[model samples]
Target: MTAPVDIERARFNMIEQQIRPWDVLDLDVLGLLNEVKREEFVPPAHKALAFVDMEIPLLPDTDEALKNGHCMLPPKVEARLLQDLAPKAHEKVLEVGAGSGYMAALLASRAQRVITLELHPELARMARENLQQAGIRNVEVREADGSKGLAAEGPFDAILLSGSVHEVPQALLQQLKVGGRLAAIVGDLPVMRATFVTRTGEAGWETRQPWDIAAPRLAGFPEASRFHF
Candidate 1:
């Protein structure tokens, strides 16, 4: 018989090898990685792959999962994003693409509150259930199109797009409070950049590209028009 997987050691290796080297050196962020049981947030069928350096599908193995864009971000990507955003205890965060609610859980642990939106009905339900099961109360999971941003809950302190987009939507940018920051992976496949935008004024914004990272395309956003000529 095969020996059981060493859960704690795997978690350690994941942090030291995959996350730390990626410049996710924030002590608070690293500590949160240990405090939260990533294995529990993962789907049972994928529990063994939780700490691996790949995206874990939120749903069980199925073609529908691919079509629905339902998969958690890779460990290093998630950790790095969290460190960049650095949500504060007094801030309210908006997270687009609530894949399995793991990212929301991480944001909620730092921010005062987190509102995560998922487009797929089933995925939204799963996120809610997973967050509840993990006893994460500061997060509110909504079943809605995240591409447009939640105007009703406008003026968030920080916003995060959990997947890749050809460009950041203006609607989402308009939802940020002045002085607030928004992070997203922008540009098409094979060349996506981790773009960060800060709302500097009522109608002003400053943008920065700190690094490059590829992620699955998030559904619901409008695709850019292409020229045939």
Candidate 2:
């Protein structure tokens, strides 16, 4: 029989080897990485893979939509994104994907409130149950298409797209309060970059692409058209 995995050791290695090296140096973000048990949010079959450096599938292998698999972003990516947005204690954050609520749980530890939207119903239910079980009260998971963002609950202090997209939607940008920051992975495969946008004024915005990273495409967002030659 296989020996039980050393959970804490693996968690430490994940932080030291993967996360910290990636420049996720914020104390609060790093500390939350320890406080929130990633394994708890992972599916049962994938519990051991929680601390691994790859995306963990949230759905069953036999599920058709999961042919490529709907998954939680890798730990380092999640930590880095969380660090970039830097949600404050009084700020309200909007997370566009609620895979299993792990990211929302992280956001909730720092932000006053977090509204996470999940397009998949099963994933939404999973997120809600996980958050409830974790005793996290500040996160609300909405089962709706997040590609357009939550406008009715607008003017968030920070917004994070937990998945990659072709481009950051203007609707989502318009929802940010002035001075609010939004982080997302934009562009297509093999060349995607992490894009950060800050709302500068009522009709002004600034963008920065700090690093390159590619992730599975998030569904439901409008696709950019291309004409075949």
Per-model TM-score versus the true fold: 0.95, 0.95
lDDT tens per residue, model 1, 106-157: 9999999999999988889988998999899999999999999999998999
lDDT of each: 0.90, 0.90
Off by over 4 Å in 1: 1-5, 61-64
RMSD of each: 2.6, 2.7
User: Any idea what lDDT model 2 has?
Assistant: 0.90
Task: Spell out the clash pairs found in candidate 1.
Answer: none
Give residue 88's lDDT in candidate 2 (0 to 100).
96
- Which digits, one per residue and each the tens of the lDDT, describe model 2 over residues 1-229? 4324698899999999999999999988999999998988999998989999998889886355343337889999999999988899999999988989999999999999999999889999999999999899999999888888989999999999988889888999999999999999999877999999999999999999999998877778766788777
Model 2 residue runs over 4 Å out of place are: 1-5, 62-69
